[model samples]
Target chain A: MHASDDGPHGHHHEHDHSELSDTALRVRALESVLVEKGYVEPDALDAIIETYETRIGPRNGARVVAKAWADPAFRDGLRRDATAAIASLGFGGRQGEHMVAVENTPEEHNLVVCTLCSCYPWPVLGLPPVWYKSAAYRSRAVIDPRGVLADFGVTLPEGTRLRVWDSTAEIRYLVLPMRPAGTEGWSEEALADLVTRDSMIGTGLARAPGGVAA
Target chain B: MKPLNAMTAALEPVAPLPRCAEEPVFREPWEASAFAMTVALHQRGLFTWSEWAECLGEAIRAAQAEGDPDLGDTYYRHWLLALETMVARKGVAGAALLAQRQAAWDRAAHATPHGQPILLENDPLFTRGA
Candidate 1:
């Protein structure tokens, strides 16, 4: 990833990475005022941020996906009721009270979006990337799924159909990508390494064998 | 990869706010702060939920009028706009002061790289409060 390219997990790079979204700066500005007025405690703020930032993130969902790939019974359970299956793994609360997992197969691809707002499954997938929240992505996601995927450098086969799910506050969707080939004997831990944040969002394909997911 | 620790500090706190079953997911640390600030301001009796809704609705309408396509992900932007306008209108803060802070943060954010936090103390222009 580039040091400052705009995408999901766009902030991740191998450098200083001090750049931030405009919303971040605006929030900082507001926080200065709130802190000055004593309306919020600095320590409390840090705890919530740390919870989502480090304690809970993509790894939570990655474990679920890896388990599905390794266990057929678990995959069936996930498809039957993703909420319980995910929560059974101990990753549920806040924005993930309701969860629906969409599987990607050879015949169809699934994409998730919040046409009215950014309704994401935060319990499983960490925070959304900047691009996913952009006006461009929001507008084009429902209207042009193929084009949006292309922008992310993803091209599906000609016969593959695209299914786009619009997220709401009550319900959220996650894309369960197809397990990559040549990973038959790999452990769940190794398989989880191939699952990226974008793959679960349907903007990217799972990493190929010996390929970098990020 | 860029170290996210520098860009966003962590935070925690939950408040009882009006919600029609709101899921309340934040895309970034700042988003959570923004949401908390809105609830905190309301708890302080600064404004009614109705008034906040009106301001947010008006802000969203204004953006749409300005050619924002109404795709919905930028709801927080409108929320920020509403918060800024309401705070200034309510006389809690001067409009000019808010404008100045906005500009200062914009400059600070530009100067900082992708992963660093933007603090008011880091900017010389933000010394008025000290």
Candidate 2:
């Protein structure tokens, strides 16, 4: 596991008064203005904001992963239609929308990056983590995916076919890396240990490193 | 990664704007992802543009009666669900391969802390807002 600066359950500390910067406050204010103009309903807009900020996030994706690793049939369904497949796992929500999960193998590699704007699977994958939506990463991933992967310590062979997916549409693409080797007789929860966020983005592969899913 | 400080932070909320007149209750911001997805599929020749438009309109109406006026706001997910329902209803891509891929992504997300970050530059919300 990545080292937590605060340690496990480190969320108890309240050191930074500035942490509650309310960066979204300005956006909410603007939304209220639009609401007054009758462009959007106050309740609905509030729902959107609260859904993103509080109710949903990346942790949801983790749950889906844990479940899929446990069930064979459900895993098959997710591969067919990620959106509904995920819903079958009981993980769908408002923002997850239409889903397409792509796979990466030893012969072929797949990567997802949004070039135009950040269009992500919110319900299943939850809100996007930070780097997937960065300008530097977006431009560079398309132009030099190999180079960026190198930066991430993921080096692919020249023979490996690199498929870069620009997630610009309503249908979101999630990378499904080949199950790591040396994981026989492992439970789905243990198998889930091997899947990484980068693997889903097509940068890294799921490996059962150190008996932990790293 | 550590959360950004005020000076270096990248995600800041922008002021909201009024909805456009007759903006089609189906044209919610989240729905923009669905619109974009259909456009992508059309570009790839997965289906004709007219077919997508027709289907989207129909889905909007169906979801409306379901008491989901905000259905459009969550378009992409709806598109996924709709696509699943439609694909099953009509049989498009093979289900096994798709499920496998979805499982793979789930594993990947579980392994990586913070998973993938949705950069604002690539986010439809930011671009459409602009």
Candidate 3:
């Protein structure tokens, strides 16, 4: 985070007021204008930011994956209709209105990309990271899933078929990574901890129970 | 690791995705603000996702035409443009009003001292008349 006083203008001694980057100034200006014009409410803006910042994130999706792994019935439900299954667990809205849960198995791996743009399952995974939205990832994921995975340092077994799902405006995807070994009889909370965001996105695998940080 | 083809190799050094513990989803505070503003406007029924998508698509295309490279950094910049364009097209706020407000903010931000909030009232040209 840039400190209040440290910025592009930090070296200048002639000015009394701090300088902000043009982009930052523009955003602040736009918000002020919108608030003053009554097009938006200041409180509402804060509420929305607060929601994404805290209440909604990959943690919500981790719990869903954990429940699916621990309970057969929930796993079936997810396979049948992921949107409702995920919503039933209280994580659905906005970008996640339509959902598909693709499972990763020893025989096949599932990867996701949005070739047209960065359409992602925000309800499940939170906002996409920089790389997921990069042109390299979007264009190359479908054409070269194995290579993309390799870039992420994930190497699949020989002959493991890879399926790449291109996210669209109508549908979003969440990869249900296979449960790791040695987690037998573990509580859902502990299981959820093993569900990394990358695993759920199919860029990496679920952390081994023993590999989890202490 | 399998060797990448020429195309993938040209786009080498793909930045690693930030781990959940490594960084926040939003890199900058303004990016979050821009994202929240768009979602808030959508929730208010000012526009639909499809509409937002179209506007964003157009913005991205325009940026690309000007050699944007379509890398990830400018994604939110396009998003903000889309939001502004959508708001203007919908008549929620006119272009002139937005421009005026932008100028006001620029002034206010400059007038604010370090560590102080940049309030619209601080804009040197600000008056309650409008």
On TM-score, the candidate that comes out on top is 3
Q: What's the distance in Å from true for residue B87, model 1?
A: 9.6
TM-score of chain B taken alone, candidate 1: 0.67
Segments of candidate 2 deviating more than 4 angstroms: A1-29, A37-50, A66-70, A207-214, B1-130
RMSD of 1: 13.8
Which candidate do you rate higher for TM-score, 1 or 2?
1
Arranged by DockQ with the best first, the candidates are 3, 1, 2
Residue ranges of candidate 3 with Cα displaced over 4 Å = A1-15, A212-214, B1-21
TM-score of chain B of 3: 0.81
lDDT tens per residue, model 2, B39-121: 33344455653455455445545665586533123444445455444443444433553444334333333443343432223
Candidate 1 per-residue lDDT over residues A1-214, each given as its tens digit: 1354546875655544245466676667667776877766676676766676667778888999999999999899999999999998999876687799999999999999865545688889876655665566666788778867765567788999999998876678989999998899889999999998889989888897889542
Ranking by lDDT: 3, 1, 2
What's model 1's overall lDDT? Answer: 0.73
Deviation (Å) of A40 in candidate 3: 1.4
For all candidates in order, the CA lDDT equals 0.73, 0.53, 0.82
Pick out the ten consecutive residues of candidate 3 chain A with the lowest summed lDDT. Answer: A1-10
On DockQ, who's better, 1 or 3?
Answer: 3
Per-residue accuracy of model 2 over A1-119 as CA lDDT, tens digit each? 24335758756443221111121222222232333344445455445555555665545565566556566677677788788877776666443567787766578998888765456
